[model samples]
Target: MRSTPRKLSLTGLVALTATSALLLTACTDASQSGTDGSTASTDGESSAAPSFDPSTIEVDEAAAALLPEDIASAGVLTVGSNTEYAPAEFIGEDGQTPVGFDIDTIKAVGATLGLEVEIQSADFPAIIPALGTKYDAGISSFTITEERMQEANMISFLNAGSAYAVASGNPDDIDPESLCGVTVAVQTGTIQDEDIAVQSEECEAAGEEAVDILQYESQADATTNLVGGKAQVMYADSPVIGYAVEQTGGQIEQLGDVFDAAPQGIVVAKDATDLAAAIQAALQTLMDDGTLVEVLDGWGSGDAALETAEINPSVG
Candidate 1:
């Protein structure tokens, strides 16, 4: 699974007594805003759409030559991102152009490589498998793992980890560990989904009732299930969990500190060594010139910034 960013006031989804009209409105709003179905900034910043203007950084001719002939000739770097992940990647207020730290940072990398960037929104789980064929790169918050490394190369950019959220006041008495019979919601195709599955298997192995895992195509749907009491807890990247809790007013609260913190990378196809190197060089350039830090700071995600770009860093 992949993660992105948001926070908004509680809309009473937790109140099962809420009218159908309200639920409809929630669905409508979610569909419009895309990720987490809210426009509220997770960082307590302005509601106005944040904009990123990558510096007019010059491209290194040497770096540009590393691109594959097809891409180099086209002069455009096509990227796939699950735009529903906010603060990281999401639909702008205009609901057309993509925005967020990932989008901005990738755009900056493209600028540094002297290529026009075309960000195509895709399913989070599908992004990885689509790389090389459909996308030149995948820019969603794809946590670098050994399993994924076998399929593609990951260039480290930022660090984050999994976190859990439950209804405010721990109403369900959910435990982050020992989740044996709990109903958990998570986005399909994410590491969180895999983690929960492993835990469920462990439960069954230990003679306990297996967890009831609820999977959704998007984190927004999973979050909605959580707030609606359909699921006792939700797991996502720390930033996403934070955003959900903050956005829901007092309806939800973070269950535990982030765990398994690791680097998230810009994914390149396994065979695309040259493209990966090019992106790594471009990211290093951004880091050296401070554009990387600027992009992270702009989205209130500076805390997760990496000091250096690593290609296929040890997941251990």
Candidate 2:
């Protein structure tokens, strides 16, 4: 019989709930003035939108000014991440040092800007809300989304999507549809969580029992569960699943194609536009110099899908 994965303890649930509340507090002020001179509320807000003069807005200057003297003077960029997401970010073979594609890319970007990079581990979903006054930026394979844009500024650097990792031999053929009535493991409070929720809805619509979506605190835990047969499949980023398959000596296989394409970005405080621009410019330079591709290559991650251009605005 397969060993069952452990459920989150009541204390853990309470802690997560409290952290989510803090994150919500951090995003409460995401409203911005619309170009039509009206106020636009984001997420679930009912307030009127604010208006802005697009003609008078100097994009370059605005982005540049967002990186104020204080941040530059600090000389160190404090980053928050749950580095358990492999290929993107993870502990090295030594098991103590943080290492991965995300770390390398962010380090290169920091070097270009003459700043020191420091990474702090935090709950994946709580990283953004923990940004204010504590961290300078966040680099945990964060996806750029309009909902997130309302609460924080995201400077996209990589094209990413969700995929599955399963035990070899492909016994279950775990596609999204196959996931119905099965136990699927995912990191809690991430885009993966949102994706699984959508899949669950689909299962319900098809008259099948919705999969039991098991939530792990980190990718490492989720992958462990997959190998232990506690879960039918592990859902995670495509690049991450690729790395895991390679590292496991074919013990695992990445199944199916990409399901959701969510561009990855660096997260800065909602009000930190200058810092966002500086990071964006640095990323652009990395792409031009071929450094970005080299970093991804080092981690055995796919490089052809990288997007060199800045896809979103510095501030929402």
Candidate 3:
């Protein structure tokens, strides 16, 4: 497969030019949430939207006590995430506070543990590697995979899978499985990115034209290219594709059911076993208290809710 780089990753691009080119990428997140493009109210009307009011949640004694000694004393859970992933984690309308189902859920978890949640944004791929050093945990819609579980403990929190999308009516008739010569767009360092790269190699070995795989820094840029006719198909986490289709006002359409459905987890450093247990307990408390349901539903991602927050659930 031919790899294409976005302006943000190309050093030759002028800084000013790269800034404008990466606007959509820097502002949006890739996690799929089936939002209807109306997260904010237009007129003066009430909506059962998500509210991350820390004051609303009270601390659970048992959960709090479960926290590691250092974390319990510090009173904070430093989380690293790619804030540009929408519905899961993203910048709020004011363009300052990070808000989304992921943010709210983590805050709720912290509240249960009597800790303050501090979210720090970084590149999605970087977040995983920086755990333990720069972040105590990561909750950026990370799919629990064997490769990832090798580096950190994955505590299952939500369910998600890959989804394919195409222009309305599938103008180019792109097939998810048979994209031998198709120009496909995907975000960098995601499972879909690696998946397509492998598929491209398979196609070439079969005497078919290699797939033209375009990699962008963020899902927003990938979706933009799809809608602007720069690519024939786009693949991302299922909820992400749904949200993109919704935001596009029917310009894009999801191709099929979410496949390879697996648990998306909160990543904890390998050495932070105590902290991981504390987080699992806190998540269970939130799940039982209906906070998890509310946050997911409010963000149009209720379908991805987990029945229980398991530790290292089977990836295959």
Clash number by candidate, in order: 9, 12, 8
Between prediction 2 and prediction 3, the one with superior lDDT is: 3
Candidate 1's TM-score reads 0.84
User: Could you give candidate 3's per-residue lDDT for residues 231-271 as a string of tens digits?
Assistant: 88887777777666655556678876677777787889988
Residue-level lDDT tens digits of model 2 in 1-316? 0001101100000011111221221122212211111112323222221121212212233333445698678877899866666556655433345566677777777776766778886667777777767788888877776767777778777776677777787777666546888888887777777667788899899899998998866565566556557778877777767655654445567776765565677888988877887888777777776767777666555453355646364422
Q: Could you tell me the lDDT of residue 69 within candidate 2?
A: 93
- Sequence-dependent TM-score of model 3: 0.84
Which stretches of candidate 1 lie above 4 Å from their native place? 1-46, 60-62
State how far residue 122 of model 3 sits from its true place (Å): 0.7
Model 2: residue 295 alpha-carbon error in angstroms: 0.8
Runs in model 2 deviating more than 4 A are: 1-66, 173-175, 302-307, 311-316
Candidate order (lDDT): 1, 3, 2
lDDT of each: 0.72, 0.60, 0.69
Using Cα atoms with residue i matched to residue i, what is each candidate's TM-score against the true structure? Answer: 0.84, 0.75, 0.84
